[model samples]
Target: MNPVRKRRLVITLLILGAVAVATALSIFALQRNMTYLYSPSEVDAGKAPAAHPFRLGGIVKEGSVHRVPDTLTTEFVITDRFQSIPVTYTGILPDLFRVGQSTITTGSMVNGRFVATKVLAKHDATYMPPQVAQAIAKAKEAHRIPKAAQGGGAP
Candidate 1:
């Protein structure tokens, strides 16, 4: 091969290799930081990661909020109408956080309860996060399927 052509080919290969490495690193970092959202039903069905931080989205069950005396720690239950998961958070809740409202809590499960690091409540009565809406819809569908099956009919 000619000297100039050989040098050009080597440089091209080096650049491509560097690009590949950078892309791979970027993907790895994203994967590490990625957080998945799950509904109470999905978590009850053992679909959520037990050790990694994830977002749990659902409606706050009616009359489920309880605050510990003289502490920021609060406990509540998040439900998808079909299932519910107990969540414990030790921080100031959002102003909109209330019973029967949509919320998303970021945390990990420990000893069968979700230990939340942050809690997010829906901004308005008419607005819900897309993931939370989808999860609620899915939970409703799942709940209906069982009833239809028991009635000996297709859902």
Candidate 2:
């Protein structure tokens, strides 16, 4: 092979190899960080895998928060009508982290406690997690569907 041609071919192969490695690394990072969104029922039932991280989501159980002294560490319970999962986060709570607010705490279950590294509270009292709102709507509709099937319409 000619010297110039050989050099050019070598550089081209190196560039293509770099691009392939970078693409693989990007995909690996994305897959690693992606986690499942867990409902309260799933957490309570131990349906979540211990190895994978989770997003513990539900309504903040009313009157269930207690802040420890002089620390940002606080404890609260997340509920989904049928069950509740306790969560602990050692950081400043959002202003909306008050009674009856909806939230999604990102972390994993450790020794029975949901160790939340981040706590995202509701935008407002009237605001709720979209999943919570959807669940509520579905519950209301379930009853309506049965009633309508039996009779003329739902009251």
Using TM-score, give the best candidate's number: 1
lDDT of 2 at 27: 85
Candidate 2 lDDT over 21-56, as tens digits, reads: 999999888873565467788876777778977788
Candidate 2: residue pairs that collide: none
For model 2, the superposed segments whose C-alpha errors exceed 4 Å read 1-36, 124-155
Per-residue lDDT of model 1, residues 99-132, tens digit only: 9888999999998899999999976546778888
- Models 1 onward score TM values of 0.58, 0.55
* Residue ranges of candidate 1 with Cα displaced over 4 Å: 1-36, 124-155
Alpha carbon lDDT of residue 9, candidate 2? 100
Q: Each model's RMSD to truth, in Å? A: 8.9, 8.8
Candidate 2's C-alpha lDDT?
A: 0.82
In angstroms, how far off is 31's CA in candidate 2? 15
